[model samples]
Target: MIDKTTQPALQRLRLNLRQLEVFLATARGGSTRAAADRVARSQSAASTALAELEAALGCELFDRIGRRLQLNENGRALLPRAQAIVDQAFEAQDLFLGEHAATLRVGASFTIGEYLLPGLVSRWTQLHPRSLIQLRIGNTSEVLDAVAAMDVDIGFVEGSQTHPDLVMQSWGHDEIVVIAAPGHALAQQCATPQQLSQATWVVREHGSGTRQVTDEWLLGHLEQVRIGFELGSNEAIKRVVAASDGLGCLSRHAVEQSIADGHLIELATHLPKARRKLAIVLHREKKLGRGASDFLAHCRAAAAF
Candidate 1:
């Protein structure tokens, strides 16, 4: 027999799945209008779906401000759960869509992607030839943004984690060394934070994990670490330090090649070792698919070996 009380949810509008999809779309797109475009529906339809979703879920998922939808704390809290639902739903879709063509999107901050990730991703491709791997590289801050937007499967970043949407687990560690061209006077002197600060330094652009930690660590002596230039790549920074008298901060891994060949020398700072955590970050709600799971495992194995 048909039940009358459940008709609105069951018969009139169907289950809340589509509305949930609309809610997620709007959250990710930043607007109901944009969400409509993603799902090929009208703006009114998307807005209605969101309204109904909020009503049925008994919580306001988004706060409408003028023409835009901004997620409130409640909405922000639901984002991970909604994203996890979508990720699981997408994985289920993969079973029907043919798993081979599904792409695993990954985000890695510059240092890890440029210096460490390619080898691991390359090895993963060989092991799972049918899977596709896509990498998005940026500073840790930017990478975190991409992860929040659901643009990537995972992120490997340097520095401590800040975002509430993401879960950060230590994947490895990187040792930072202060370096200069072989003959720079700082190399010969006892590298106190004060002496290090006095010289002009070329550093990674702001929001880089490297820049963030170095900035915090050098707080009492900012005057000493004067800005010479803010370059984008670790390699470029190393090159600048190599060709000029400017000093730089670098990962021990990034400069090992140069240090062995005697181009850049690590300064012995009065401060103890400068170590930054390399963490694997992903949305707390995002379920790892088979390919992503395989990749995360490979990352741990590679770090160990």
Candidate 2:
């Protein structure tokens, strides 16, 4: 296997934005025709661009099985770098259009994106009327990946673990509370381990920060609890818990409105209160632009937890 790091740097100079863009579009939409539509180019042009890009990079980026293209091992390895390059180019352009009229690209995990960031973004916008705020929402891992790749100026995440390539700044503390519908059997009483173990659980889908924390905190204690359903979003989980007899563990911020409206009830568990740090993440080597720095400062000063 050829070590990519050992490759000549000259190959990098041969890369063009159009080629990378075509490569990305083809990789994502899985065909040159689709890629052509995305990049507004002829199908033959997209195909030629991808082929030239692969040749310049010294490896085939995709496996051509009949007319369908799939990312091979080499393609998979190059995809992140290609995405980072393309996204960073756009971000750089946006950032340099005007320093004070800066455009900030922010990525956020589910909890912060849905509940916390709107207010912060609003406040930031008020402070800097000329500033542009673009927000991307994903699970903790996805947000972290975006930061590490320099796709976002910064990220807000609720997961306990931090990546080696990223730096995490303590933003605030969040409580992870177990909850249920008001009519649930355990809703009105403190639930013991055995009693909790028997109740069905509805949880955020696997990649979610909430799911990770629950695995570490809840499952660690009630090792054998039944998981009745695994849901994709915190809102979905909340809705399921509120309408059904199942129980769920989620961030306090996520369920505050539901709990207040009597759609859900925060349960008293035998275990101690579960809390985790919410953090702002960025690549360790990232040099923050003025806009990013300003927003980071605002986050540090504002008490949102």
Candidate 3:
């Protein structure tokens, strides 16, 4: 060997995957304990890793706000780059293990999660049998937040809501139908707008995409709407409307089975058809890995069919 000791020393790497992992988890979870749980480390270890990372970068990444760790300017600036590096590392690992060994994280709104994605996920799982998918279900706004925060790889939601940090792609469309219990007075007749406005309604909570569309569609046609109840779950709304005289406006996929089973009736109304755009959302800065890319392609193909 040539004189190894006399050669210039290679600069050591100051940052590491562990430190970045802790940083990312802390940024998302807002606490070292949460970060530790996410990364399967002790809280003390996570805190040390975060501290070491800040020291290496010569800047504090997060602001200490009581018990929470909020991303300061430095953290925000590093997030996308860190995410890309970590994701590429995972992708590299999967390359050696095979495509089916990859994992995907998905966030979906209530309607899509409960009604739409099950069949699609089932089909996808059949094709990629060794793949793992973690699906988080939330309302549209929550899904948007998850995608923006880098907590999920991709999100599917209903509504036209836009986020500055996200790219939204039109995935498909869904029809919103007004339904009533079979015994409700409006169930058997073509209800006039005035009659429909006078009826009590059971609807989704305010943050829900279905609720947003319902307000726009109903308020556009009727002078005013009478509120009866606001529930979170689609199944709960369906049951409440089926058991009471309250009307409900929900996605067709959410209520079609109930209507077929005679638990609910589609109201014959004079109002125009209501449709909402379904969209796929992702962080604008995110570089999707093979698993996410493949799933997105699958969604596009499914939508086309």
Ranking by TM-score: 3, 1, 2
| C-alpha lDDT values of all predictions | 0.83, 0.86, 0.92
lDDT tens per residue, model 1, 74-108: 88777777766776776777787655446888999
- Model 1: residue 147 alpha-carbon error in angstroms: 3.4
Question: Could you list the CA RMSD of all candidates, in the order they appear?
Answer: 3.9, 6.5, 2.3
The candidate that wins on lDDT is: 3
Clashes of each: 3, 0, 0
User: Model 2 over residues 1-305: C-alpha lDDT tens digits?
Assistant: 87888687746588899999998888767899999999999999999999899888899988999888998989877766776676667657767565546568899999999999989889888887888889999999899988875568799999776798788988999999999999999877899988888889999877788999898887788858688999888998998888899989999999999989888889998988889889999877666766778888988888668
Worst 10 residues of 1 by lDDT: 8-17
lDDT by residue (21-71, candidate 3, tens digit) is 999999999999999999999999999999999999999999999999999
CA shift at 177, candidate 3, in angstroms?
0.5
Clashing pairs in 2: none
Q: What TM-score goes with each of the models?
A: 0.79, 0.74, 0.95
Off by over 4 Å in 3: 1-12
Q: What is the lDDT of residue 121 in candidate 1?
A: 84
Among residues 3 or more apart in sequence or in different chains, the pairs in candidate 3 whose N, CA or C atoms overlap within 3 Å are none
